[model samples]
Target: MSERPVSTTDLDSYIADLRQLQARRRPAEIPDHVVYPAGEITIPAHVSHWAAQRPATTALTFEGTAFTYPELDDLHRRLAGWMADQGISRGDRVAVYLGNSPEFVIAFLAILRLGAVHVPVNPMFAPAELTHELRDAEPGLVLTNRALASTVEEVQPRLDSPVPVLIVEDGWADAIAHEPFTGDDGDLDALAALNYTGGTTGLPKGCQHTQRHMLYTAASATTATQLSAEPGFTSLCYLPIFWIAGEDLGILLPFVLGGTSVLMARWDAATTLDAIEAFGVSVMTGTVENYLELMARPDIGERDLSSLVDPQAVSFVRKMTPQVRADWAAAAPSSGTLRESSYGMTETHTIDCVPYGFAADDEDLLAEPVFCGLPVPGTDIAVVEFGTQTPLPLGEVGEIIVRSPSVTDGYWRNPEATADQLVDGWIHTGDNGRIDEQGLLHYLGRRKEMIKVKGMSVFPAEIEVLLAQHPLVESVAVVPTDDPDSGQRPVAFVLPAEGATVTAEELVSWSRENMATYKVPLVKVIGALPMTATGKVRKHELAEDAAALNR
Candidate 1:
């Protein structure tokens, strides 16, 4: 897979290709305050306010069940009492290992209602992955559905102290209906959650966030999306709530907007479109793949999608490029704008820079690769020199530094990692990017993921984004392999479009003509690219495959 393509010898011959061609930068302008209703600022506060004011309004709809705001609040309050009785209390960690369902939301808020730290574990985790989280979090209790209960049970005995597991079932209503939690609310500054984040490299690390952090994320995101309760704001939640991105879009955003969420356990283009048409879903947020899949469906244009507005898109396995936005607008005329969702990480509770309606205003902004629009209101984003931490000039690519209200307290129980990553108040995002003169941030890629070929730096994401433009390419992942001459060389694993008979040589030729000679990578055809549960490419897996070929 890592073998150099014969058609391209400019990499080895390398005479006049020191400078890599770069796309012109056109940054989007940051906005002032995003419009959001004042008052109720926290999740519990929102629940309480809505329950008292708009009790009959539906807050969540799952499968065939619907719960009004008051009913939803009441049920979680009862569950919180049950958790309290099970020895979960303020500051205690309670892990909710469940899929996307009403149960997940119920368990989540119930845990928070008790002032306990909510630890969301991905249900797709295997026994080993599950064990690592449980061990690190050391939760006082675990909540899961019947199907996932055994996975928790399997990992419980491995913990230093066995933790209690509660299966969220119908009987949960009976267990706590007689009693409701009357506990005091957690302090805004109190630790609220352990949002876990990781890659293909090592054990997942937990980012400690506070209720204040969560509240700011929820509120600012509401502003960013321009969500309003008037005339009703509704969204679809098919993405797993366990993920930071999912937690924000699926749960927090609606809570802040005082809107309704129509939940689906997972992604299915047909069901999502049906939900949008049936429920008048006004706003939608998901990966780029979701919108693409929707457009691919023949019935997309036929569906009654007049109510659906601009869908918030996250760039994960697939980037939200100019072409995608153009295609989406053509396929669904009602979609007002299609742009990258919030630019953040779990460390910032997932929203540091916000993108809303920017693409609609500036077509040039869409052309920038990995463009993360504007910092959150009241937050500071700085680009600094890699080693000295000296602030870099605008438009000069460097390390990104973000200090926001939504920034995490720190990594849980990992002082060494925390001290290294967090300085003063800013979180040093290991990502490489640059803020343009217009203030738009362009995330070049992960610093470690950059390939040093000959003497030039090549960003893998830029290569992948470029290759994906070809009509014959379905997907592509680029990984760096060691080279004797060049410090490292990019090896691309190409997934051709179905039934397309394009060969590696043809791809290499296309790359040589379309891209910089040094930037052109060795192309290898593959049936499928390895992916994580939340739709992230497993670059480590690809790198390993490339390493073996080199060996």
Candidate 2:
């Protein structure tokens, strides 16, 4: 697998080609419309429909085991019964503390089948972090693997309503008896799941989602993947299923749409590409970091990836130099159309997606900083003046506010935070972006100081506060520096006590010990960060300074 290098000119030429393609026919002029059937029911029905109609079709490919629709359905039924037998009644919360295995899928559907909320906890979460969500959700039953079972056991002593941890494989005999004998009949008003935010700041909060919402969103997302009518479309499911947005759109949507997925334990670039070729995957979606690493792989170009398709998001596109954007796109294996750019948070149920090949006039400028494209159907996107809640003009940048059916209701229990985020039915998406005349959205920056490092969200304020607690440190400021591999990496600027000397590696190690690996800064130093009149760190200046340091 030899690498294929594309030039800046070649990149620009392709953008020009894409512009010509867009100018030839407008999306509005195409006269195509999506029509959904009336009386769309809840999620359990959708799953049941697929199970009945395509019982023999491949439902999931996980760990070399290809589960047929019938097998998948039976697993869900047995799991549902198991939940009931374990005293998990309808409307109860069931936390699935497992990885991307058959058990995760079965556990999720089973919880929904019994009309209970399915809270999928991140398997990568530390015990303290897992305990927080456990306390918040207060699930009656938790499904865990052998590896995570101990974590649950350790945290059980600390939680108020510590529930029974059922090891899926080891406790199969005990769990099967609890299989939900009831069919796909349940209340739609019941909660579907409580998706917690990836807490870089404090404890993750529960995002309340219902069965109807998940079903509808899954249908729309299914269409978005272009898998509605396309049979045998292979999807790559690597991200943790705990994140409701990715699980629904990336995994479940494709399944319900009659598509296949090549499951992995986690993201391994080499393994991912090999699987793409091995399973004949057509569509792959992940953060920008994932793509960059895959592209940089030693033999990326030689891989038989003729089946690769749409990319949901790309990070480097937003920060790419004009030449680099074109270069990157041209370099992307032309097997699948990188047709869209999605800009959304987990809270909005992953709303605000924009398709590529829409804006012709701004193609040159647009290609430089990745444009998020236009809002999806049945969505209203607005760039409003900060703090005033007033809509901005066409090209003026402001806080992005979205109103849509996909928008989550609110944060669970945290009424104060919920009140702050949800105001007047408009979700204040903390991203900064502007819309062009043709309604294409271009991402500017984030409203808060949260930095998206690799695909992980890292808030500098969280790290700075933690480091400030150190005895040797007087002041600290963390700023994001660009990296070709990892979209962004944090570099800490510290003002130590007078003449104290601390190496960057030592500071980095110190941060690693105190926080999550992603939360720690990669680079650390001894110096005071530039500040303004109000004593706030001059972040923009620090960014420029970091750029110079890199040079």
| Top-scoring candidate (TM-score) | 2
Tens-place lDDT per residue, model 2, 1-551, is 11212233543453344334433333543212232322366655655666677776677888788877667767778878867777887779989888888778877778888888888887766655677789999999888888878888888898986698888769866665554466665566667788887433445678887766665565555443344535666778787777765586446665656667677778898888788888788777666556657767778767777777655444542432334334435565556544334667777777455454443444634553457664555556676766545666667888777766667778888877677667666677777887665556677777677767666777776667667767778888778787665667777788886778777777777776555566677654746668899987787877876665545
Clashing residue pairs found in predicted model 1: none
- Candidate 2's C-alpha lDDT? 0.67
Off by over 4 Å in 2: 1-39, 177-180, 183-185, 198-201, 287-306, 311-313, 316-334, 359-365, 461-485, 490-515, 521-551
Tens-digit lDDT string for candidate 1 (411-525): 8988777776777677878889987766667788776566766434466766786677789999889898987655578899999999997888899888875565777888889
Q: lDDT values of the candidates?
A: 0.74, 0.67
Candidate 2 is scored at a TM of 0.79
Error of 1 at 450 (Å): 11
**Per-residue lDDT of 478 in model 2:** 77
Residue pair clashes in candidate 2: 1-299, 80-180, 81-178, 81-179, 81-180, 82-178, 82-179, 354-374
What count of clashes does model 2 give? 8
Candidate 1 local lDDT, residue 22: 12
